[model samples]
Target chain A: MSRVGIRELAAELGMSISTVSRAMNARSDVSAATRERVTAAAERLGYRPNQSGRTLRRGATGTVALVIQTNTARTEMGETFYFNLCDGLQQTLATRSLDLVVLPVGASADRDRFLVNAVDRHLADAYIVSNTDRTDRRIEYLTQRAVPFVTLGRGGAADHAWLDLDFEGVAAHSVARLAGLGHERIALASDDRDINSTWEYACGYRRALAEHELPADGGWEIRVPDTPEGGTVLADRLLDMSPRPTAVVLAQETLAIGLYRRLREAGVEPGRDLAVVGFRKNPVCDYLVPSLTSFEVSLVDYGRRLGEIVIGLLTASPDDEPVHEVWEMTVVPGESDAHPPCEKAAG
Target chain B: MSRVGIRELAAELGMSISTVSRAMNARSDVSAATRERVTAAAERLGYRPNQSGRTLRRGATGTVALVIQTNTARTEMGETFYFNLCDGLQQTLATRSLDLVVLPVGASADRDRFLVNAVDRHLADAYIVSNTDRTDRRIEYLTQRAVPFVTLGRGGAADHAWLDLDFEGVAAHSVARLAGLGHERIALASDDRDINSTWEYACGYRRALAEHELPADGGWEIRVPDTPEGGTVLADRLLDMSPRPTAVVLAQETLAIGLYRRLREAGVEPGRDLAVVGFRKNPVCDYLVPSLTSFEVSLVDYGRRLGEIVIGLLTASPDDEPVHEVWEMTVVPGESDAHPPCEKAAG
Candidate 1:
């Protein structure tokens, strides 16, 4: 069935196209009586305004593009993160009658090329860039084009609106918690990716160690793949250490599950033999023999904050400063790090 | 900076709007030399055709929407399922220059209302509706309107294209596997949702029981929420059974995690005390104390098949048959169902 266009609706109502358009748009210039008649007639005739036509006239797509990384080695965590975040984003965007369009860029695809096409095609009024890296060319391109965009994570781009999780704060707190528990040689398992959060996490780990007057053991700050398999690799590395670190902080909490499994297989028990702190408390952490000590991030609320900031950036004038903020993560204590270092490990 | 418009490009090249438009569109009427010159100048001036304008002219949105449910109680599994499926969908759609837009419907929202709005707004050239119910109003509405759409799961819609997983086959296979091991009393834990798969699973379980000459015990069939917490609730219910079931099959594998935890806490080891079979093997199943016996679904390949079917539907003539297919699931052997009923329970 073909949609009834504005021309047909106007012809049926015996009214001018401009009047029908204005009435449909709910413009104040159209008299209330005429607006009601036009609305009734349009409804009766099933005449919904075409999005493309309306978008061309208004210079607004009534859409926001959320660019995310997909087809990566690890997908569950990232997909879950965005899925929850999208709920909040959708709820918030609904208030303004804007649709959220997710543009999933394959891991192997050229990220900047995808962004360029989206921009050139005017796919959305604004864009939300996720899985950010330290030197992001996408952010740079958006910045140069003066397009409205907000990054889910901050990068090296200059003076743009961004909302990032408090990875640094979580790292510092986890280090302090372990240090106060008499853990001197605390290890840090950071993601090998050049993600901004990884860098922040490493920085916080180093700063906390310095504050504790502990030697910066290069071997303790090993970067590995941010996956369950990588967690097994990390466990192997820890076992290879002559005097293993008493405690470890994992930047990617996903690694905790594999770490626990591998450690147990090696006759080492988490919370009893070694202390572990991870980011993101989830099902795996909850079901682990000894619950994992991890940080809890309310992704829905974070998504809402992102939506608010995106709206702010879109509506704000040029003189208004671009917002930059961090979302705090709360620590959910578990049995994974219940004890201090074992006596034999003091050496 | 403002985007360079077609009018400005035409003015700069001293050509008519028609000539420039035809050249940019690569019309055969335009000489190759002129087409090349127009393309070079357009590129140099950064004059890309507006998507809205092009869509209005061509009457094709060049977008395919994948609608999925979100914000439900059992989110991890659903999110993971769609996330993996989307990768294949996107990869296949990319071949035809069609962008996949994910429209996540909130669990609490009116689903029909969402679909109506999406349809009214002409959101995409086609849609892939997922989480199908037995009598889906959205499918009915889409079918009535003659909208181009394909469901991810089969529904009650008439003569429509659909691709569904073989839930019936999986259920039958699981029942036979346990029944073959000399288990007379078997239980089936099905999802409480009104989804079509749940109905098929229940049917298969009942049919299998009849074929094996075992009583179709009403008490053995229970419908529960499809979440880990639901799994805990299911465990409690099973423990309360007067003559507990010897083996069980779970329609949703997510419930297996919590069931394992609760059962272990109750001093009833899964594989030793009672046999368990689950659907969709994953990390939890792999890491379970006794690996879960579950079906392996290659979601990416399933997604690719869906993409192929959708494209077929879109390009096929009216006289052509509407495609309907069921994807087969493979069983992954595990230790969860390593034995039959214990000797003491034989009575």
Candidate 2:
């Protein structure tokens, strides 16, 4: 049997298409009795209004496209982050009868062009762009187009709405804790990407060092891929240093796992030989012997706020102010960062 | 400045809307010269045909929806699986200029209703439903509707296209390996969900035990959540067993991580005290003290095949044979599954 459509339903009801549509849509103009009648008839007939028709008429797709970068090396920790964030976003959007569509831009694809085409084609009513760069062209284009959009992280364009993690706070707190423990030399590790969070984290590290009266050494700043292998390389880099740093702060949690294993293989204990601090309390981190000390954030709550902000922007009047907020992360102290400092750094 | 649309481009080029569209779509009816002129003008004017209008005219969305189940207990291994699969699917879809949209159904929502609504709305040209149940109503609906669709795993509907992992094979191999290692008592562990894979795994386990001439103990078949905490619970359950199994096969890698940690805490070494086998070679599993012996699959390749199958279904004639294939996973040997049956009765 062919699928029943609105036209067939209207024909069967002996009513005009406009009345049937209005009744089905529950418009204010339609009477309560007529709406009930149309709804029951529609359900009985198994009729469904085509999404394309509704979208064209309403000038909205009622979908939000979240752009995530696709890389072959995405760690489980990375997946955890995206999954939790998406869960929160999805739950919040569910309240408004809006669907969330995750669009991944392949590493080889042009992300800016993809976003532009997605906007031009009206693929979604709004967009949430993740992995934002410090000087992101996508943000500039979205702002100029005046599109209803929210970024997962801050970009150079401050006028537009964005929600950024408190990476600076995480760094400052980690550094302060380590410095108070009599660690004069502290290193910082972050992904090689020139994203806003990495920049903010590095700045936090520098400022924290200044406050602690510790000299900033260029050798201490490390940029590597956010993979397990990257962690191993980080360990090597630290070991190769003339006088290794007693403590290190990781911008991502996966790196800490790798670093711990490699350090142990080299007879360097994580907590005893080198103080370590990770960025998130990931599930795998639970398996770490001396549980990793990391910053924790309610990703679902953050995703909810992001959803609320985007929905507010979408429905609000043109004169309403754009929201720019920072999501704060609390430190979850563990055995990894409890030690004062390593007496002998390299094994 | 306002964005340029197809109408504006048509007016600027002195061509009918249909002619412009035909040329843009590279329809054979339009002249090559006209196509070139229309394409050049469109590029110059920055014109983009609205997706909704095109979707309505073509009766296809030029998008493929991949439905992934959402749960709060999703482990990192789950993420890895989805991420890699999506990457492969997306790459394959890109070849046909089709977009891949991931639609996650929340744990609390009705999955069947969700799939039905998506189909009714004409959300995409094709659908790829993951986490299929043993008796899935969604499969029946899709098959009856004759919609272009493929499942990530087998459902009750045999006529439809599906690609399932070789869970039965894994179970058989793991059991055989343990039985060959002089182990009479062996256990099988799987997620608590009544999905097709879990059912298949259990069937394989039973068949393998029968072949080995071992008594099938109802107490040995353990079902739990697929999280690390689930693994901890699994460890306690094993410890409490009257005569604990000397060897165990885990259907998910995350469980192995938890089980290992808990077992070690009880002074029960994983590979030594109990011969353990895991399902996947997940990144975190690499951090296991004794490496995990698990199955390895090229998820990207698997995803690519799924994408190809769906695309073929979408474009092929109605009478074409539907594909139903099983994906094979190779075993990667590690230290965790190398030991024979333990000598001691209890720790």
- The model with the greatest lDDT is 2
Per-residue lDDT value at A74 in model 2: 57
Q: Return the DockQ of model 2.
A: 0.23
Q: For residues A277-345, what per-residue lDDT tens digits would candidate 2 score against the true structure?
A: 887777656667688999877666667667766666666555656767776677899998788887666
Give me candidate 2's TM-score against the actual structure: 0.81
- TM-score for all predictions? 0.82, 0.81
List ranges where model 2 is wrong by over 4 Å.
Answer: A1-58, A76-78, A345-347, B1-58, B76-78, B345-347
Candidate 1: residue pairs that collide: none
Q: DockQ numbers for every candidate? A: 0.23, 0.23
Q: To one decimal, what is the Cα RMSD in angstroms of model 1 from the true structure?
A: 16.8
lDDT of 2 by residue, B277-310 (tens): 8886776667676888998877766777777677
Q: CAPRI band of model 2?
A: acceptable
